[model samples]
Each structure stands twice: as C-alpha cells, then as structure tokens.
Target: MDQKMFCYQCEQTAGCAGCTGNAGVCGKKADTAHLQDELTGALIGLARAADGNHPTGTTHRAMIEGLFTTVTNVSFDNEALQRQIRIVHQEKEALIPRCGSCESRCGRNEDYDMRMLWTDQEDVRSLKSLILFGLRGMAAYAYHALVLGYMDEEVNQFFYQGLFAVGEDWSMEELLPVVLKTGEINLKCMALLDEANTKTYGVPKPTVVPLTVEKGPFIVISGHDLKDLKLLLEQTKDKGINIYTHGEMLPAHAYPELKAYPHLKGNFGTAWQNQQKEFADLPAPVLFTTNCLMPPKESYADRVFTTEVVAYPGILHIGEDKDFTPVIKKALALGGFREDTVFRGINGGTQVTTGFGHGTILSVADQVVEAVKSGAIRHFFLVAGCDGARPGRNYYTEFVKQAPPDTVILTLACGKYRFHDLDLGCIKGLPRLMDMGQCNDAYSAIRVAAALSEAFGCEVNDLPLSMVLSWYEQKAVCILLTLLHLGIKNIRLGPTLPAFISENVLNYLVENYGIAPITTPEADLKQLLGEA
Candidate 1:
C-alpha cells in the first residue's frame, strides 16, 4: 500500500506547493489523508449517481457533509471519516441499487479515485482544485444553514454538479466556467446562510464586548456554528457555567439572541492558529463547532471538545445530541481563573466591538452615503478573512492602523482580531473600524457595498471601496471566487496566493480581474487610497 499523501488545498502547503510527503502540514497523518481521499472519491461516486436521478434531501445533505469533511483541519479521525464514507455509499446504493447487479457492467456509476484529479495536467488540476476547494468551503456554510432548518435547493444541487465536474476530463475552457460558477453558487449559499442566521437569531446590531473573564466556570466555544453555540448556551444556562466565544464564534456577541444571555461572556483568544499556545494550561474546556481545529497539544487535549463533524481522534467529541455535559463538567472541575482576569486582544485593548451585519449597516446607508458624498469619508476598505500563524499576517493590523481618519474599515472573520481592539475612532457617529460578523458575513459586506453602489449609481468597483483580503484556508477561496463572480475587480489578496493556482490560471486572473498579491502595508495603503 502507498503510505504517502498529496494535498495542497490550503495556504500552508509545503514549499508553497503540494504536500507530497508522509504527512500534511496540518499534521494529518498519511493514513488519515488516504481516508480523506477515499471519502472524497466516495462523494464523487454519490454525486455521479445523482447526475440523472432527482436527488432527495438526504442525498444533498450527505454530499454537503462529505465534501465539508475533507476540508483542511476539519476531520482527522479515520474512523469518523470512514463512517462518512459509508454514509455516502449507502446514499449511492439507495439512488441506484441495481447498478452492482447488472448483467452488463457500466463504469458510469463507479466511485472516482481522487488520484486521477491530483495527477492531472497542471492547468486542469488547478482549475478543478479551485472548484473542489471552493465547494468544500461552501459546504461548510450550507451545513451551518441546514442545521438552522434553512436550505436552498440551488445551493444543494450545485454540490452534485461540482462533485461530478471534479471527476470529468474537461478542458480549461470548460472547467473555468465551473470554477467561477462555484463562486456564483457560493454567493447564493452565503445569502442563504445570512438569511438563516438573521431569521433565526434576529438581525445583528452593534454591540460592545469586554475581554474580561469573571471568576467562574466558563466554556470557550470556537468555530462558526451559531446553532451549536446557542444550544450549548441553553444547556449551560443557570448551571453556573459562563460561555465565552472564541475564533469565528466571536461574532456571536453581535446577534441579539446570542448576546441576550448574561452568562455568554466575551471572547477568550485571538485567531485559530494561536490555539495551541492559547489553550495551554487554560482553565476552561473549549468546544469546537466547526473548522480551524489544529491538532491539540497533550497539555490541553483532555479539555478540548469537538462537535458537528469536527473530529480529532483522541479528543472528546460531543455527538449529534449536542449534549455539552462533558464540557460543562470539565469547566466546573477547572473552576476557571481564581481571580477576575482581563484578557486583551493582540492590540492590548481590553474590549472589542461586533455586529454591523448588512441590516445594521444598511439601516445607516443614507448616513454613509452622505459622509462619502461630502468627502468626509474618502474610502471604504474591506480588510477581512482568516488569520494564520504567518508573521506577514500582521500586515492587516498595520493596514487598518495606517488608514486615513476619513476612511472607514469594515472587517470580518477571525482576521479582525489583529486590530479589533484598537480604538480606531469614529467618522460622524460610526466607528472608523466596524466589525462585520464572521467570515460568512462577507455576505453582509457585499450587501452593504451593493447598497452603496446603488445609491451612488455606480458599480461596486466604481464605489470608493477597496477589498484588501487575507486568506488562510478554503473558506477564503470560495469568498474570493464569490467576489470575482460578482465582477468586482481589482481585489488585493495575500499573505501569498494559493499554491494550487497554476501559473497560467494566475496569469488569466491577473489579466481579466486585475487580482494582485498584496505588497507592503504602506505601498498598498497608498495605492488603495489613491495617494501613491
């Protein structure tokens, strides 16, 4: 059996290229990587079976969950991955039970070996990589929405089309449209998720959260699943356990339903990449509800709990029942900090603010337009995305810090942690820096930009808005695709582009969309603000 693995579906791949060694950079073992490949292949087979047949809700969910399972840092447990693979197979068999017993065999319903895609021509491989990775990211959003009892049929069907396309032998011309279409569909997916969240939790509003941890038992909830966090909040209510948001969950502070809980405390840590160090000897048990789960350290591994498709082999996983009893017990045993401890963000500020969803921002659309029209606000910069261990990520912090007083910075996702604590002051009554929910809240940013464009009678690009984005994983890939799909050009993406994008495809994007890698903060800021 081959013991090596090949994967480059993320920003931290080896040598800025594919990971083709015994283990992936994310600490996925060779065996686990192989299982993920098998799971992906099985998903392709399920998608192939649904190509002609009308897929049911069960089939759509299986496809979404399967694709999301293979995302970087999502699933490392071989057993759990195998279970998902079996579920895919069962769905395929239910779709076409007679395929295996036919007198004459046709390979149309066979499972795809992912190695075929991995070893294809460079350009085709790059295009398919974009589609597949973008689909994976979109699936995460779809899963979040599904759990909230909201699912878009178009978004669900595209999962099958995307998976089947991954297995097809197609030209760059044929595949490029699918690549962009992944983004197009993901835009709808984000919209669906936005609707699911707003309808379920009420529109988010501007809310300020402190960084202090009161002396009591607390559970730190990470990842991007609001439903899971809500369930935990309900269960831990009046049980003497405080809930603190971490990573992408920091945006929970903005939602009215989530923030109403008095015990739902402030954020605890910075970005996902800092978990290993941040969780070291912590007093509370951290529950991960979605992606960005780094392999836990031995010191705090016992206190880390995972749920909702996030699984690490040795970590305690809270199953579908969403029972957080184990986590509560662990937190109570630890008893939190003996004294009130104030935890500042990376910027040394003791508190940060969030909420500024599309509803909140658009409610003040007239004010924003008046400010921009009067030249009181020169530019609007959407500096957002995930945060990683790369030292270059500090660019976001500096970029926001150096923005002119007349400019407004709209940020989302964990990347906001870089400067969310800094008091950037306000323009009129609005803060110079506004926190716009989580990574998925890129939809909010889009809505706000579209409203601004409509008010000014210009395209989104023509508005005084520049998108300087920093991506660290697959979610960023899909959001980037969504931006390109909307025909919003001149996007500046960095801490280096994805290693999976081949030279030709990179050139194509550069020629058509004017997407460029970010340079120094000073030069980029000057260029963005038109001062260079």
Candidate 2:
C-alpha cells in the first residue's frame, strides 16, 4: 500500500504495523510526521558528525532537545520541527565546518534518511526502532537532569552512539547489542535524573493529596517535570491562586520544598489521556510541562499553556525563564468554582497517597523484610507505566483491586491513578498501595528491588516480585528496556504490545525473557501467584 507517511514510534500506531495514513492515530498530520522524520534524520547527521570530535555541552543539549522534539505528542508544529532541524544542522556544522566544502566529499558525515531504516527487513527495522525510540525517551530524562545541573558523560555520549548506530548499515548481530545497550544506558540516565531531583528537591515522603479542589482560582500542572512544577508554584505563591497537579505531576505533592507552598493544593484530573474531557470548559487554566499532551479542544485551547520541550501549534509556551505569569492570569481570569469542588479518582475515592520513593521505602526495609518473613506480605506487584486511553486499560484498576490481601502494590507514573485512591489496608505498618513517584522514578523501584534481593540472598527474579506494566509512550519504552537490560524476567506487558515490535522480535523476547502480553487480570493473577 502506498502511504504518505510511515510512523510506528508510539503505542497507538495504525493496524499494529505503522501509521501510513493521512494522519497518525495520535493526531499527527502527514506533514508533521514527515517533518518529524526529517528532524530525526538531521539528528542522526549530527550524531555522525560528533563521532570523532569532543562534543561540548551545547552539542549534547542540542541532541537531547532534537530527539525529544520528535517524541509522540511532544511537538506538533511543523515550523517548530523545522527550527529544530536547523538547530541540529547548525550543531553539525559547528562540529565539522569544513565537511561541506571538502574536495573529495566522503559520504560518511552525511545525514541518513530515515526511510532507509523504515524500509529494511522487519527484524532490522524492529531493532533500529527500539534503539531510536529508546534514545528519544532517554533524551527526555537527560534533558530533565541537565536542567537541574546534572549531566552524565556516559549518558550524554550514548545519544550520539545510539543515533549513529541507527544510521549504520549494520545487521541484527551488530544492532542487537546496541539495542540492548540503549536500555543499559537509559538506566544511568534515569539514575541521573533521580539524583538531580532528590538533590534539588528533598527526598520524597509519604504524603496524602486530596482530589478536592477548593474554591479559588487554580492552575492544574501536568506532565512529569518537578522543576517546572516548582517554578510555577514559586511564581504563583501568595497570588491568591492555588496550584493543582495532574497526570504524572500528581507525585509533585510529595516533594518537601514543593509541598511547603500553602497554595499548592491537591491533584486535579486523572492521567494525560483524560485531559481533553477533563479540561473542557474548566474554570482554570492547565499548564503542560512535558509529553502526553493531546491536541487541545477548542473549548479550553485558549487556556492551555505549555512549557519546556512541549509545544503545540498555537498554545502559549512558557520559555526558559520559567515565568508562569500568563498561566496565573488565565487561572485568575477564569475564577474557578463558586464553592469547593470535590473530585474522586476512578475508584471513587477522595484522596490518593504519593511519595514512597526508594529513600522512604528503604528507610522501612527492615519492617518490610520482617512482614514478609511473618507472612503478612505474600508478594510484591509493580503495576506501573503511563496510562493510556485504550479500552482495556481498566485491567490495571481491576488487577490492583483484586490483588490478594497479603500482597503489596507498588506503582509509579499515571497508571497508579487507576487505583491510587483505593483504600487498600496496610500490612505490618505500611500501606498496601504505594505510589513510587513518576515514571522517571522507575529507578527507585529498581533500587528497592536490588536491595530486597541482597537482603534475601537471591536474584531479583527469584524474589516474590512481579512486574505488570502498562505502557503508553516513549518514556515507558526506555523504562521497559532498562528492566530487560537488567535481565529481569517474567514481565507481563499490556494492554497491547507495541506495534513496532515485529513478530520475530516478539518471539525473541518471549522465548528469552518470558515477556507475555497481559490477558485477563484474574488469569494473570493466578499465573503470577503460581496457581495457573
């Protein structure tokens, strides 16, 4: 079939092959998709140029920004994408200013067209897609850390290596290792971001956030950037406006310095997918700090503000200055609800608890070990990742709701919104359901799992821990790769496998890692419990 565009970088691709229609499933137009491909090709060229030179901080930042611009739902404006392409080209020129005018032009430094990778054999395409998409996700995490004054040489260099590999004429034998290496490096990237966050903001603690919106003007801050949320909170302080967290930003309520702001109220909406409906005719403005931004509806489009790397065609973006005055004005102008408006989570509960990062959990590690030994905690289920708009996503809610009384639920990202408010009673002295911060905080889960394995004198997979994950975007891609890279096995991934994974690649994963797409929660629960 002839198509204007080809994209399978997201979970919502068409027909589980690629988005080859006039518009992608995520509302990306053909022109925008083509521009994104161009932008990616330009980034590969930049990586190619950086091969022999020592890339400066500016080079690394540009590469990260360019990769992140191509992530799904991050940038929809063709003009913005074209601008990114120009920036990449400028970086490449700065790295090798004489390459363009060389007498004997060697094609080694030329930009690689993405169509070549897209049209390769299925397995090759799948492996390259894994590397490309994983790099995109890791770039976002690295960008966050860079903003907070943290940068890792290894993590920064991997961007160039991975991107260069994507453009290489390498077979599966060569590319496969690089694909796995993407996961290996992403682990470092996530850890860097974790260090930046916990150091910038204090270590997170168990904090209960309300779903109720008190009467007053309020701005709902969404996405996963704590730095952005903190700046907004500071700017809006004592301005007679309340700040509410949304989507992945819900965990922001647990940060000590952020929670200190009295006007920083509770969570507002659910996950990112629910924004269109939830933000419709809302009295206050909504500010997006990162990805999972759906196209704003006309109803509330005027009140939507984007900051940092997130951009839409007409949305007002708060620049690097971190000034949030426009968002505040919009919030004050809307003049929120006449009285207090109470909102409940999907499970019909009024409050959800967050924090519970590695620091908090490890602080009580002895108690957790004792509870397990005493049989009060039978198992640990990490039901985490981004929340999607698919029909079966409620499987997470059901899985958490039906977990055995003796088991504990550790969750992260917006997926926890499915059951975050459920009043699952405690085991020993800890709440059965623990929110482990945002998707980036998957590092915390890894740390805790490693510590638990050391405490039990067994491999991580040998422990009574299960990973039941739901992925919606590229961030989830990098996190899943990190899990695979660590040799963690028996992972259950769903509500649907990525369309980009060819059947052969899926088989390789299944046969080697025992990764299975989730079925019914009851059946999977039985299998995970060794009863199937």
Candidate 3:
C-alpha cells in the first residue's frame, strides 16, 4: 500500500504513524495537513531569508499566524491553509527583493524543505524540533499578547533565529545548546505574556467558580485567554446570559476583574479533545478564544463561535468589537439543557477547585515553607500539560492518584482534566490539585517555584519539585523548554517523547538535564520520590 500522509505530531494521530489515509483523527483531511506542512516550510524559508536582516512587523505577524494555523486542531480548511502559505510567501518576497533580476538566483529565497530538517542527525533534528515546536507554541501565546497590545521584540527575533536554525546543518554539540536556549527565551516570552495578561486584566486572585450551570441561557468559553473571556464577559454582562469557562478558561475565575462579573459563572467541560462530544447538542453557544479547538461536529457546529487566532468556516466569529451579540443570541436560541444541568468531571466530582494561581500560592508562602520545613510536604509535582487520548497517558492519572498525601500537585493546562475532577482532599485547605490556570499559566508554576526557592534561600531545582509533564502539542514543547531553561532537573516527560526528536537530541537532554521518558506510574513514582 502507498504510504499515507504521515503526521504523528499529536498524541491521537492515527496508528501512531500520523493520520495518513483520508482524514485525521481530528477530522482534518489529508490535504489540509499537507498544506499546513507547506506553510511551515515556507515559514522556514522566510526565517532563512531574514536571518541576516531585520524582520519587519508584517513578516513577524505572518510568521506567528502561519505557526498558529498549524497548531493541532486549529485549522482544517485547505483554502485557509493555502491563503496562509501565500501570506508567508508574500511576507518573504516583501522582505527580500530579487535585486537586479539577475539570472544568478539565490537559493536562500526558496522555501526551506521540512524534510531536510526532519531527516538530519537525531541530535540536530531534536534540537531543531525543540526550536520549531517551542516557537510554534510561543507564537500562540505571542499572538494572544499581540492582540491585547502586548508585543516583545526579543520574542519576535527569536522566532526568526529558532526557525532559521531548523534548516541549518548542525551537530548535537552545535544544536543542543539552542534547544535549551529556546527554553530560556520562551521564559522571557511567557513572562512578557504574564505581564501582559495581569497588567491588562489585573492579577488573578482566589475565587470560587461553580461548575454547575444555572438554568436559562449561557455560553461556554474554552481555550487559554483571559482578555477574550473578559471582553466576552463585558459584552454579555446583563444580557441575562451566564458564562461558564471550559478548559484553560477555567483559570479566568482567579482574575479580579473577570471574576467580578457576576454573569461569569463556573467551568463547563473538560479539555479540548473532549469538546466535540461535550458540546454536542448543547443549548448554549461555545466560543473559542484560542488553541486546542478540535474540528467541529455537525451536532453543534452552528453554535460554535471563533475569535482572535481561532477561525472555523461558517461558525459565527465575534470580531474586534468583541460585541459577542451573535454568541449571546445563539445561547438564547438554544436555551441550554432542560431545567438546571449539573455536570461532573471525568473523575466523578461534581465540583472542581481552581484559582490557586501564583498570587494565592505565594500569599501563603510562609505556610508552604513551614509545611516543607516540617516535612508535611515531601515533594511538589508540577503534573501538567495538554491532555490527549494515549493509553499510557493514564500514567498522569495514576501518577496524581498515587501521589503521597503530603505531596502537592501543581497542575496547569488541559492534562489536569485527567484528574481535576478528583478531589484528593486538601493539604491544609489547599486542594491537592491546585490549578494554576491554562498552559500559559505555566508562568504561575514558575512563580511558585521561584518563590519557594526564595523562601528556602536556594535555587528552584533545590526545592522538592519534579516536572512530570504530558505534552501533546507545541505549547507543551515551549513550556518544557522554559523548564529546562531554568536549569530544572530530573523532569519526567511522557507518554512518549516527540517523534521529531532524534536519538542524539534525546541523549543530549538525558545527559545534561537528566530528563527521561516516563515509565509505569508506580515505577516513575518511586524514582521521582527517590525510593527507586
């Protein structure tokens, strides 16, 4: 049989060889995936062209848009993908004009083949994969920040450097450091976003968000953005429509300004992967503010809405006005589930607790320090990342399940969905699973780590914290890079390392940082706890 279009970039890709055949597990057709790859290749070429020159605002925006478009489940239309490819080409051609129209053509102006990077030595490939995936995830964050009038110069420049390196010939010794550099730079990028978000929407505080949906009209907001959710909350305020957050949006409850909106109700569903079924025939319209949007099912497609970096054909898109009138109208039309709808999480808990952001964690810094000093808290596990459908991923579930009662699990991103519903009770009133918000809220994890280190007068790694991460996409990649950038050690990553990382690159990560693929929850737990 002819080889299918291989794209195992996501955890749920078909047969672990990518979604070859006709359509992706995400319902993306093969052609759309191919076009996305083309867009990526063109982005590499654009970066190569700008390697020696200044990348203009237009080029930067195009680069961010191109990468954001390729994020899993973000786009499914081939036409949209082609338009993005054209935009990448236009940005590149605009940056570097063919001087004198000479017959001496420069290969530098041509699209950089992704295969060239993919087929290289394992180390080089792995390092490049880190840069590519890291930048892709960073672009998503950057795009969100940019929309909110926040942009960082260093972050934009690294986008070029990271992409340019992907097409370069380099060894493990040469490329390994860039892998970590990607992380280092992403820290700055994420910090910029943190400043942007908190500055734009007040620092998040502890707030009780109910998961129960009140009877009457309501809208479900998902993805990782507070500003968009806030704007939606503002527009819909007093419209008689209640707003429930879903996925990363759950953390919005912690923000003072957002939580103040009485209409902003509790959380709705779990992570993005479960959206199709979760939203099926839902009475209320769902608005996507960012990534992790799976392809729409016919069941509730009409009620789906997109805004800012999120787009779906025929779905009502609330534009810059953030008016949200259309979404509000849709919710009233659907009328939500009959009577009052009470939804429980995957772990069978009717209510899940969040809002334990950096602010809340640091406010009780003295107590946490006391707890640690007294041996009440043995270790801290940052068990977070994008949740997916892999079997072994149950490792995160079991890992959190098996965490010693005294240990604290600081989780962010959708991976928490695996166990967010589980009420592991609390350690001194702090819920066992403290959600620090979306993946971008990894900033909160870093903040808690840094604060704990300060309290102990030691480096972050010296604290009893192990990053047991589950990555399914580029955002996770960038966050992992950020962790490594901080010189964090002994991270346990699963369900499997990215296929893009070559053996050499894996070895470099293992040798330098002691990062390892996850084993059984029992085995990994023992090793993490130092009992193995």
C-alpha lDDT of all candidate models, in order: 0.90, 0.89, 0.81
lDDT of 1 by residue, 1-532 (tens): 6989998887878888878899988989899999999998998888788877777899988998998898888999999999999999999888887855422122486788988998899999999999999999999999999999999999999998888888999899999999999999999999999999999998999998888988989999999999998999999999999999998998888888988999998989888998999999789999999999999999999999999899999898999788889999999999999889998899899999999889988998899989988989999999999888766888988999998899999999988888999998989898898999999999999999989999999989899999999888888999999999999888999888898999999999999999999999999998887889
Per-residue lDDT of 450 in model 3 = 88
What's model 2's lDDT at 411?
97
Off by over 4 Å in 1: 100-107
> Which rank order by lDDT, best down to worst?
1, 2, 3
Give each model a TM-score: 0.98, 0.98, 0.93
Q: Which ten residues in a row have the lowest lDDT in candidate 2?
A: 99-108
Q: Estimate, for each residue in 1-532, the C-alpha lDDT of model 2 and write its tens digit.
A: 2348998887767876788879988989988988888889998888888887778898998999999888888988788888888888888888887855422122467778888988899899999999999999999999999989999999999998999889988898999899889999999999999989988888998999999999989998887888888888888878899999998888888888889999888999888888899999689999988888999999999999998878899989888788888988888899999899999998899989999999999999999999999999999999998787777889999999899999999999988888889999998889999999899999999999999999999999999999999997788999989999999999999888998899999999999899999999999999999999
Task: Using lDDT as the measure, name the better of candidate 2 and candidate 3.
Answer: 2
Misplaced by over 4 Å in model 2 are 1-3, 100-107
- Error (Å) of candidate 2 at residue 40 is 0.4
Clashes per model (N, Cα, C within 3 A): 0, 0, 3
Give the alpha carbon lDDT tens digit for every residue of 1-532 in model 3. 2234546567666765456686778777766766777898999888877766667888889988888888887876666678889989888777777753222123465677666764566566667777887888889888878877888898888887777667777666776677778888888878888888888778877666666888999999888877788778888888788999998788788878787888887898888778888888688898888777887888889888887657776677676677888888888888876677788888888877777878788888888888889888899899999888777878898999999999999998889989987877777666677888878889889988888888899988777888999988888888888888888889998888787766766777799899998999899888888899
**At residue 27, what lDDT does model 3 achieve?**
71
Best by lDDT: 1
